[model samples]
Structure formats: C-alpha cells, structure tokens
Target: MTPLIQRILLATDGSAYAARAEGYALFLASTWGAGLDVLSVLEFPPGMNPAYPINDVYLGQLRKEADRHLGRLADRASQIGLSVRKQVEIGIPSEKIIAVAREHGDDLVVVGTHGRTGLEHVLLGSTAERVIRGAPCPVLAVRGIKAEAVESAAASVPLAVRRMLVPIDFSDCSLDALEYAVQVAKQLDAAVTILYIMEPVAYGLDFTLSHPSELEAKRARLGDRLRDLTAAVTGCGLQADEVLRGGLPADSILDYAHSQAVDLIVMGTHGRRGISHLVNGSVTEAVLRRADCPVLTVRSPKFAPDHRRVIRKPEPAASSG
Candidate 1:
C-alpha cells in the first residue's frame, strides 16, 4: 500500500518560528509513523557578524549551531518513538533545503516562515517561499504560533489536525491536493471543508446582469458537483462538507478558514516546470501567503508512483461555472 507520507523533511534554522515548525513536524511524523529527517543549513559568510568574519573557526561555529538545533529536534523525535535523522549542510538556505529534500526522497518538506538567516521574513524573497516554489514534494509552510495562544491552551498536548480546508477550482492540480488531503483526513480523523467560488461571468454577463434563473441553475449544477465530490470522500468513511460562495476566491477562502478556525489549508499547485503561479497571482499562492493557519501545497502525481489517482474533472474551467 502506498503510505500517505513515508518520509518528512523539516528545514530549520533554530529560530523560534522554526521551533514551532519542529513541534508540528515531530507531531506529524509520530502520527503518520513516518521517518523524519531534521535538516539545518549553515548559511554563513553573510548573515555572520563582522566580528565573526569568514574564517574556518566561524564556519565551525556555524556548523555547531546548526547541529545544536538538529540535536534538539532529533531528541524530541526519538522521545516520541519516531524514526528521525539529522542533517547539517553548508550553503544557501533555500538551495540546500531543496537539494536535501530531493536527495532524501521526502514526501513532505516542513519549514518555518522565517529561517535563521531571515530568508523567510519577507514573503516574496524568503527562503521558505523559495523552497515552496521549488521543493520536490509537498511543502508545508508554517507561521509562528502566538505564545499567548499556546499558553492559554494546554500547549503540552500535541497539536491536532481536526479541520482541513481544500480549495478547488475543478483543476487537475486541485484534485491532486484533494486526494492527498482525503488520505490525511482519513488517517488523522480530521473533517474536511471544500471551498468553491461561484463566478457568474461564465454566463457571458456580469453578476448584476445575470438573470435569476441563470444564477439559480448555476448554483444547482455546482452544488450537485460539490455534493458528488463530498459524498465520494464521505463514502470512504471520512466526514466532509462543501461551501459555495460568490466573491474573490482567495479572500473568501481566508475569511472562511479564519471564521471556522480551520487547522490546515491544503491547496494545489502546478509543477515547477510551468511559469510559477506566484507570477500569475494564483489563488493558491495568495492563500498560502495569508492563511491564518499552516498551508500544505501539493502538486500533481507526475513525480511519484500513482495509486489509481483517477480524479474526475467536474468540467473545464473556461466552460464550467
């Protein structure tokens, strides 16, 4: 049987945000019974202080710091009875992160929004963003959790994946993500919420000019499709529901996720071979950047062995409402 996630690689730079991501990666590794590789890259020579300079001694110190971070993560993984390994690399953070993930055949790469080198501090030119753009597998970009929020709850209790959100546009890439999310929900006993934006321009007229009957008919067809898909998931013994809204897709997604307190947002992306969705202002990229919770981006199955992933397309985007 194809496991949902056989291997997980976590890229950390020992920042507080990275620590938060480590907790999540460790939790997921334990839950999925997957091997965890905790990787830390020493992006020295630039972020290093002028006093430290670029000498062998400073390089050694950087390696030691990276090891210190990996050691902490590996210890936690071991305590949880997880199979964990540690990796320390020397290079640019994003390049090394993608290279390590590719070398290890990691099914998922977890990263904090900001790295030790502050590559992810700015969303556009950040290390985490670059990794998301080029990683070989699914990328989980996690932002730092509020300390007050963690403290108010029983923070020691492991984080849960109770609610998952998947935004679909009836595209192949989106279906690939839905399949991945379904497997995860089944494994973790999480409920899923599928979001579909209702665009009225398909009728060749603006929303204001569309006839009420046209609008009603459009809703009926989309609702049927949504129900069919949601039922397909529930048929697998997993709970699922659908939401249909009319507005900008990304804004609607973020609003619903926040109001509903979704734990994870799973969206689809075309492979790295194409022009990046980032340049095209993709809804998936927008949600990834602004979602209140963690966002998991999955590409199509071209990169791996397929397990009968025959995704039924509702219709083509140009024609589908």
Candidate 2:
C-alpha cells in the first residue's frame, strides 16, 4: 500500500470551487493529521502587458489584495481547528499550482471542479483535469459544496467510513492504491473491500477445456492478494474483505461501489501508455466521469509495489493466417 498522506496541497482561486476544495482539504487534514498548504495565484489584469513595467504602487496594492484573499482561507482553517500554511503565487494558475505541489512534496492534491460543460470546457480545459493528468501524487476532485459544510451540518453522523472499495488488477500501482486505502480505513476504523475484475469474462466465455480449472485458480490468487494487502495493516486495526467480479473492469468497479455504498475508491493510474495515453483511458475516464463518490488516483513513485504480482506484457494472439 502507498504511504499515508502527510502533506496536502489545496489549489485555490477565490472561486466557490476553490473554497470547496479548501474545505475537503481541511477535513482530510483532520482525518490524517496532514499539513494543509493553500495556494492562490496572482494574475495580471486584462489588457495588461507582461513586458511593460508597472508602477510600484500598483504592485504593492495587488500583493496586499492577494494576501487578504489567502488570509481568509487561513482564518477559516484556523477556526475549524485545522493547521494550515498558505502562499500567494504570481504566474499561470495551473502551472503555479503544480509547481507549488512539486515544491512541497505533497502526497495529495485536492482541487474543486466547477463542472464546466459544452464549449466552455472545450475552449478552456479544466484546471482540475490538467493537474490530475500531470500531478506526481494522487488528486481528489471534490464536487458540489465544500464537504466541510456538509459534514458540519450533519452531526451525529454514525457512518464514519465503514466501507472502502479499491479496484485492483494485481499490478504494483494498484497494490500501492490498496495500501493507501488500508491506511485511511485504519484511521477511520473502517473496513475495505478489495475488488478484482476478470476482463475476459465480460465476453461470456464458456470453455470446458484443459484450462477449466484456471478460473477457480485465478479466484484463489485474488484471494491471496487480498490477504497480503490486509496483512500490512492488521495491527493498525481495520477489517478487510475481498470481492471478485467477472465483467468490464470499470463497470464492475462502479456497480460494486454503488451496491456496497463504498465510502471511497482508491485507484492508481499507471501513467497511461501509447497514443491512448494522450487522453485518459476508457476505464479511469469512465469512473471519473460518473462516480458519485470521491475517487483517489495515485501516480508513480509514491505507489507501492506488490511482491506477489507479475505483469507480463500481453502478447498479441496469432492471426489465423
């Protein structure tokens, strides 16, 4: 499993979405004992030329304004009893936010998306999507109102993360995600369900050949992986369960999560491959598109490796020449 989140970066722009991101970040900080770093970028006003030198008076005034904006976040965070550090940056919004995340060695980046649609999204891609594609660590996209308000308004909430769903393909990246999920579950006194999808079964295979026993064997293998994952956090004290489904990976994951009312989904994006890498793949892209719950995606390096896993690059089946 991946390491617990110790440092988190919240990219804010004074938008309601940014505030929402801040709220989620604060909640996570409280849950994991993580440090919150809030950032806001300073952009030149419209029609202003970067090459032109501006008056010192205007520069001072602008910096003061930016400071006030960021100060509000700190104040709110403090009031909520969440420890926070904030900064005001001057550069492109997405770039500056990414650079700050890189500098801080943050394990998670939380950002709110305004849910842009149609031509607007086509013309100006989402900052949240950009960061997700480029970030070195996991990114949580919080939607709707800031989750803090939701949590506060609903006190006596008995369901404090009881079930976590993690979709794995026996890959190192997926194992890393599983580890991360286990750590979170431990903190919340929750249980986890490790899910694996048998892709070929999606096509309705019914073969009683020499490999008739392979299906059961594969199920047993998945069971072993689940055991090993939970073993790492057994002492930390969290119940772990396993589920194996046969069908499309994304569909299976989504159906299971909804059916089980999973609190969260911890997944790993293996840095996309080939030309398709230019865009998010079908499975991940699909999950992110319609998932009602929060989705945590881990990139490379921070992801843990599974010792019992072996990934042999698929060999193209021979053509009937």
Candidate 3:
C-alpha cells in the first residue's frame, strides 16, 4: 500500500479554516492522486433533543443547511479535478468525524483549528484538538479560519513546497518519522534536512567541565548514525542532510526551520501515554503551535520482534571420545 494518504477526509463546519483546509486538501489529493471526501458536521441546536417533542420542519431545515454546505464543498473539490464525496452528520463534530474517517478507510483527516491558545482554547475547547488526540490516522489541523467566508478566500498558495524539515532524537519513533519524511521528500522531488536537538537538560551545570569534548564525541557518533540513517534514502535517489543544534528541542527545531524557510515540518508523535505525555508534551504539539508553515505529524508504530540467541549444549561424551 502507498504509505502516503490515498483517502482523505476533510471535515468542515462551514468555517474559514475549513475552506483553507479544503484548498490544501485539493492540492494534496491532486499531488498524491488520492480521493477526497469532504464532510460537514451539523451541530445539535442549543438545548434541543432529538428524543424530545418533535418539530419536523426545524429538523428538516437543519438537515437542508447541512446538505447545502456539504454539497458546495463537494462541488468545489470536483472543480479542482478531485474525485469527491461528502456527507453530513449530526452530533458532536469530532466524534462524527472520527466515525466517518474510520468507516470510509480514510488515511488522513484534515480539520481546522481556530489557532486558539491560552484562555481561548480553554474556553471554547477546540474540536480540532480533540480530533487530533482521538483520530485513528494522521490529522492535519489548519488553524485561522472562520466558518462563514470559506468560498470567497480560496486563493492559490504561490510557494512550491520543495524541502521537508524533520527533527529527530534518534529514538525509534524519531527514526520512523525520519523514514516517512524521506519517503515524502522523495515523492515530492525534494530534499530532506534531518535536525537533531541537544536538549538543555543534556548539558546541566552539574555536568563535567569536559562536557564540551563529550558533546563533540556524541555529535560525531550521531553523525555516523545519521549517515547510516540516510543510507537507504540516498541509495533510493533522494538527497538528505544532517544538522545538529543545541538548546530546547522544540524551539531549536522551529528556529532552524524558519531560518531555512522550509516548506514543511515532518515529525513523529511517540503517542506517549498519560502523565508522561502531559508533562512532556510532544514536539508535534509544540511545532503545531509555533510553526509559520505546514506541519505533518506521523504517529510511531509499536511492534518489535524477539531475537534471543540460544546457546547449544555440546555432547561431553562425544568430545571425550
């Protein structure tokens, strides 16, 4: 199977961000020769229960509006030469989107975030954030869109995305992310820049005075590992580079990307559990918050084989004979 997204679900709430997502979705669909499925979730009207006293007319009107929204998105996607499909569902937006994506075998889910931070995200509780946490596949969150003005602002992004920036920590997850990034860069006929951040904690005051020498040794070792890391990709006719930087992991990553004006940031989420993930938020989240460009997050897989060497016993009698 093609690892790149072949079936994409673009969820819209008639928001401006949704519209921008649709435009990006179209571009991705065309570039990857994928199918586009646009979905709009109809929220339950305030304090209205489906089980309560009926009003067919009102419900029908709501459904009609939902249909109208989905239809417009479908038409627009079609105009962009994408094979499009759409559906409107009523209930919680994130739940319905997750359901539809799973039911339709969507490889990627595209949703819009309002770019809420601090108190705003807390007050409103972002649906995009919920979906990202709960999604079965990779989720692309595009913030900064209002629901009402989607159609009017569909403009082309003139920049051609050619370089992909990938941050690696040499963990299994980071390695997997690097692999995915290399594959994507190869597909786009672009180059890959692998960034390794030397965390601040790795160099505390308590550390030895010869820490600089130790760091240099470690850098050389990491360079060798990076060489091995890029071997397969380079062999497959892709260009790759390795960069080492020191500082906060996420900040360093974002800074490097901005300095290089990279088009995309591809990183992996270890998808850590509970307190660990909460205490040490994923770099994916940090990049999502700070990046001026697009970010693609690949979730790491978790299957390993057991390979223990078994020592054989010699026949003592035979040896003596």
Candidate 4:
C-alpha cells in the first residue's frame, strides 16, 4: 500500500513543547520514510512599525535567530538519519505555517499546543488551534509535557501507536477520520478502539425521563450501529473494538483513552469558525487541548470523490494578460 503520509511539515517556535513535537515528527518521518520540512516563523507584534530603524534591526535579529534554530533542528534530524528541509518565514505564525503546508501540499502538519485554558487561552489565542482549523491536510497537535517529564524522556521516548482511539459520531467527518485511522493501524500493526459517546440530555425540570427498559433498548440499538461501523475495519485484517459511553463527549473520550493507555487519538473536526464555533464548542478542539497522546484532526472534505472518472483530463492552457 502507498504511504498515507508522504510529506510532513513540522512548525516550531523553539519552545520545549515544540521540541517534543519535533521528536514526534522526526519519529514519524523516519518510520514512514517520508520527507520532512522544519518551519519556523518570526512573529512581530501588531501595530509595530517595520519601517523604523530600530524595528528593522530587531526584525533582522529575529530572523537570524529563527534561521539558526531551524538549522540546528535540520542538522539533528539529519544526524538521526531523517532528511529534512528547513524554512524560515516572517508573518503571523499560524497563517504562514498553513500557507507553507498548502504550497508544498504536505500530507501532515505537526505542531505543539501549550494547553492553556479559560481566560488565558481567550486572551492569548492558540496558534496550534488556528493551524489545525486552516490546514489543507491532516494535523497532529502535540500537547505540552511537564518540564521534569521532558527532562527524563526527551532523548529516547518515541510515540507508540500500538493502540489508537477514534471517537465517532456517525458524521462524514468522523467516518473519514476512522478510515484514516484504519489505514494507519494497518501500517503500524496496531489495534483501534472506536468510541461512540451518547451525550446526556437534560429535559425540563417538570419533565420525567423514559423508562429503564426504553433506555436499554436505545442503548442496544446504538451498540448495534457501532458494531456495524467496525465490521469494515475488522474485515481489513486489523483488530478493532467498539465502546459506547454516556456522558459529555470530550470528557468521556479522554477518560476512555487514559484508562486504556491509548498511544494515539485520531478524530475529526467540523472546522467551525468565529461565533459559530464559540457558541457550539468543538469536541475535537477540547480533546486536542487535553489529550495525553498526540491527536490527529482531519477536516471534512469539501467534495466527494468521483469514482466514475477513470481517465485523467488535460489541463487547460493559461492565457497571458
């Protein structure tokens, strides 16, 4: 089978968390024998005048520092037998990272999130979140590890994909993520645990819920559906298991993953933006922020595949203005 991930882009800010992300990127690239790109962006403060002499000097210094950091990372990757290209760009960090991934048609993007929450996260928006929302392909968001843990495991720790957890909601986006997860499982000879969360509903205080028998019947039906979904995966010659839980989706998924010691989490995001996303919080984003393992987020495809087309069409010539 062809490799699912061919080109990987790893964006770094020279932080400890980013270094951990780089470790995962390097390991994956070596395992897949894929090309890797190390990208670093120099971000300037908003409202800063670039034309000012002092500002220009500061910008040049920042660029040089970024270059040096990327150069060293590239050298490290090479020393470990992974070939990588280094890139340095000046722009908004997340925007430039996404732009580079699109321009290169990279199959996967790896980034680190600091896992800030509440008012802090609101005031300082997450770059990893924006990149995942806008990336053209799949994104792997690595959560930051504590300093002491990094100190102990930084050198030899590798991301183990022996067990993978995938949360499914029967949405096209979730199914797409499942398919990708199955492919990765096949490659890694890993097992996949599919989870379906039935969110608890609270009726009005005056209303009473259904009978126990009726709830059991509903749970049985959902279990059947989950089994049906896993049939394809099992038929693909990989071990698969299904679990149905009742609770908050994100919390349930994370709890299951931690309890099972899952090495990876593959899930889908609807990619909602702005007010819509704020109002309807994203389960995927929540999981990404707190997942102990690396979370791979695949956005829903805009267009379905055309299976009827067997032959390729020639490109039209461009007209010169």
Candidate 5:
C-alpha cells in the first residue's frame, strides 16, 4: 500500500523546542522513507532603528546566521541517513511557514510549541498555533522537551506511535481525524482509542425524576454510535476501543491521555478565528497546550468550497419585502 504521508515539512527556529520537533520529523521521515524539508523563517528584528544606515547590514548578518543554522540541521539529518532539503525565508514566521507548506503541497507540517498559557501566551502568540490554524494540510505540533531528555531519547532509539487517542465531536473534522488515526495505526501497528465527551445536561426541578431515564437513553444512543465507529476501525485491521466521558471536552481528553499513558493524540481543529474563535475557543488548542503527548491536528477538508458544496444544506431564502 502507498504511504499516507509522502512528504514532511519541519519548521524550526534553532530553539530547543524546535530541536525536539526535528527529532520527530527525522524519525517519521526515516520510518516512512519520505522526503523532508527543513524551513527556517528570519523575522525582521523589532525596535531596530529604521533611520540607521547599518540596518541592512544587520539584516544580512541575520540571514547568514539562519542559513548556517538550517545547514547544521540538514547535516544532522544526513548523519542519520535521511536526506533533507533546507530552506530559509525572510518574513513573519507563521505566514512564511504556511505559505511554504501550501506551495510545496506537503503532506504534513511539523513544528514545536512552547506550551505557554495565560498572559504569556496572549502577549507572545505561538507560531505553531497560527500555522496549524492556516495550513492547507495536517499539522503535527510537538510540545517542548528538555535538552537532556531529547539527547537521551535520540541515543536510545527512534520514537514510535504506539498508542493514539482521538477525541470526536461528530463533526467532519473529527471524522477526518479518526480516519487519519486509523491509517497511522495500521502503518505502525498501534492501538487507537476514540473518545467522545458529552456535556452534563441541566434539568428543571420538575423533570428531576425523568432525567435519569433520559440520561440512560442518551448513553445508550452514544454507545451505539461508538460501537459503529469502532467496528469501522477494526475492519481496517486495527485494535480500537471507545470511551465515553462527561465533562469539558479538553479536560476529559487530557485526563484520558494521562490515565491511559497515550503516546500520541490525533484530533481535529475547526480553524475558527477572530470573534468566533474568541467566543468558542478551541478544545484542540487547549489540549495542544496542556497535553503531555504530541498532538496531530487535521483540518477538515469538508470546509473547503468543493467539499462543502457536496455536503452543505441549502439555506432558505428571505421573502421579498
């Protein structure tokens, strides 16, 4: 069978977190015998003196430094018997990364996130987050790891996607994630666990007695759906299971990952932005920030115009005034 991922793009900034991402990219590229591209974006320095005559010279120096860094990363990949193409561009990191990934039609874009939260994350937005939101294909965001840990792990053996978790919300994106997870599981001989989280329903005091029966019915219905989904995965020759939890989606996902010692998380992102994103937030993003394992986020192709036209329902027109 043909490999699911043919090419991988790894974005780095010469940071420790980027190094960890590089490790995963190398492991996957070698495992799949896929082509690899290493990219580094050189952001123009902020607060530089625009009036200074030597500004251009400083920019040249920065470019040279970035090239050298990328070259060294390429050398490391070569030492591991993996050929890689190195690229350096000057622009906003996130925008440049997305543009390159789109231009090359990469199957997957891999990058590292610092996992910052609250004021820190707000003030210093994550490049990984932006890339995941806008990339044309799936993205794998690796959390930051210590240098010592990375070194030790690299010396020992290549990483494996042994146990994967997929959180589903019955959306097209979630289904796409599940499909990708199953494909990966098939390739790696891994087990997959599909998790569905339902919010607790609040009922009026008058309906208190009947709520228990209603809840039981809902659970039974969900169980049926879960069984169907698991059956489809098992048909693909994979070991699969399903979990139903009641709580906040992100919290439930994280708790399950920790309790199960999951190695990887494959989830879907709605790619919401601006006001809508602010209001609804994103469970995937929350899990990306807090989860201990790597998160592979698949943007639903159903959102594309071509796919949308197939599945979208017609809207009612307004009456003429």
Candidate 6:
C-alpha cells in the first residue's frame, strides 16, 4: 500500500496544547519516514505600529520566545532520528500556518486546541479553527488533555495512533476520507471503525422512524453499505469494523469515539457539492473541535503515492488448511 503522508508541518506555541500536537507530529514523522517542518508564529501586536523604535526590542524578545518553542520540537524530532526544519514567522497565526503549508508542500498540518471541548475556542475565533478551515492540506486539530494526562500521552516513546474512527455520511468527500483513513491505518498499523449515524427525521417529527417496516427497510440498506465498507477495510488486511447508530451526526460520532478509545477521528471537511454542507450543519467542525483525540479532516488525498513500492497481497492461503 502507498503511504499517505510524506511531509508534515507542525504549528506550535509554548502552550500545553501545542506540546501535545508536537508529540503527534513526531510520531507521524517517525512512522512514515516523513520530514517535519515546525513553525511558530509571533503575531504582531494589534495596535502597535511596527515603525516605533521601542517595538523592535519587544518584537525581538517575542521572536526569541517563539524560537524557543520551535527549538523544543526540533530537538524531539531529532531524538527520533527524523529530519526536521524549523522556522519562526511574524504574522497572523492561521495565515502563517497555511502559508508555510503551501510553501513547503506539506502533506499534513498539525495544530492544537486549547480547552476541554475546544469548541469555545473556535467560536471565539481561535487559530485552530481558522487553520482547520483554511489549511491547504489535511489538518489534524488535537484538543488539549489535562496536564498529567498530556504528559503521559506525549511522553510515551514510539507513540502510536492505535485506533481510528471515521464518521461518514456517504458523500463523495466522505468516501474519500475513508480511503485516506485506510491509508493512514495501513501505515500506522491501526484499527479502523467506520460509523454511520442515521439521523432522526427533521421538523421535530421524532417518532416518524417508529414505523417498523419503514425503519427496517432503511436500516437494511444502510447496513449493506456499511458492511461493504467494512469488507474493504478488512480486505486491506487491517483490523476493521462497522457501526450503525441513530442520533445527531456530531453527537453520535463524539460518543462512539470516546467510548471506543479512538486515538484519531478522520473526517471529510465538506459535503456533496454544496447540498448538505459537510454532514449537515458543520458536523465536521463540531466533532473536530470536541473530539477527545486528534481529528484529521481531509478534503482529498493529501500525498502522492510512491509507484515503486510493492503492494501487499492478502494472505488468504493461510486459512486454507
């Protein structure tokens, strides 16, 4: 199978959240043998004029601090024997992150969220939300855990994203996300769970699905599709499963992810050519902000496959005995 990530860009500040993101960046780089680019953006003061002479000293000090954070990331990557490049920039945080991604052709961009749910941060216009919305490559928004948990999770050597959850609505973009998730699973040796939530009917007609025959028919069809997807994942020789639930899409996704101990949540950023709007009312962003683990949002495949790499064939003959 072809690897999905070759170059990763990590955006950080000196916060605990960024530190967790750095751990993920290093883990992915080591797993994929990818190069890492660590970036820190020192935002210009809002009302201060750059022409003021005293501001130069202030800006210089901030630059040094940003570089300090970037340096830590570089040292961590080096300890893993991964190639890394570091940079410090002065600009808007999200804009600088997107610019670095475009300039460096990063396959993935990793950023961090600052709260328990991370939604409040996004609603208040946090850099993480903007980066997730505007980044040119797939963005992984990792929410901050408690300090002790953060230290334990980040300090685990040879970190692994052991189980991944992908919530799909069957749109083309969503299916693409599944493909991307499968590629990631192949690389990380992770288990994949494909979840489909059959939302309750609209207009407050909650009991409409209570009709036995009608609900049964729809469930049958959705089951078939979900099982087909599950088969595809298992065919890749990776551990895989399918889940069917009924609730609001975002709620169901978050609930299952938390209960299943998912290490990552992979999703599509948008929906079928403007019909539904990314899983009905920005569900991707909702889950992206609230998910416990890092959420990977993909609009399409992020990396070019290496053609020289040989494919792995299924080992069906072992079962013949």
Report each candidate's C-alpha RMSD, comma-separated, in the order given: 4.8, 6.7, 7.7, 7.5, 5.3, 7.2
Task: Give Cα distance to truth, residue 101, candidate 2, Å.
Answer: 1.0
lDDT of 5 by residue, 1-321 (tens): 446787899998776556668888988888778789999887755576633768767767877887888888788888878878888887778899999998887889998885222222331258888998899888999887765576776677668889999988776668778877777787788999999987656555776544678889989999988888898888767899999999877788999999999989999887323343465467888888787888999983322222212112225578998
- Per residue, candidate 3 scores C-alpha lDDT tens digits across 1-104 of 33466788888766445556666677778777889888877666556776565655666677787688778777766786889887878778888998998899
Instruction: Name the regions of candidate 2 deviating beyond 4 angstroms.
Output: 1-3, 42-48, 51-69, 115-125, 145-160, 202-213, 231-236, 271-282, 301-321
Regions of candidate 3 where Cα sits further than 4 Å from its true position? 1-3, 45-48, 51-62, 115-125, 145-153, 156-159, 201-210, 271-280, 300-321
lDDT of 6 by residue, 1-321 (tens): 355788999888766656677778887888889999988887875677765888888779988888887777777678879998988887788899999999998999988877334343453267887887788888888776666676786556755789999898887778878888888888888999999988765543564435678789989999988888888789868999999999878889999988989989999988632323443447887786677788998964564645321222224455564
List candidate 4 segments past 4 Å from native.
115-124, 204-208, 271-280, 300-321
Whole-model lDDT, model 6: 0.79
Clash pairs, model 2 backbone: 1-179
Please estimate how well model 3 matches the true structure, expressed as its whole-model Cα lDDT: 0.69
- For each candidate in turn, the TM-score is 0.85, 0.72, 0.78, 0.84, 0.83, 0.85
How good is model 1 by TM-score? Answer: 0.85
Ranking by TM-score: 6, 1, 4, 5, 3, 2
* Candidate 5 structure lDDT: 0.78
- Per model, state how many residue pairs clash: 1, 1, 6, 0, 0, 0
- Model 2: lowest-lDDT 10 consecutive positions: 115-124
- List, residue by residue over 112-169, the lDDT tens digit for candidate 4: 8862222222312588889888999889888777656777677665666899998987
Q: lDDT tens digits, residues 93-165, model 2? A: 6677788889999888987654222221221256666777788778886554443555563354432457778
Q: What is the C-alpha lDDT of each candidate?
A: 0.79, 0.67, 0.69, 0.79, 0.78, 0.79
Clashing pairs in 6: none
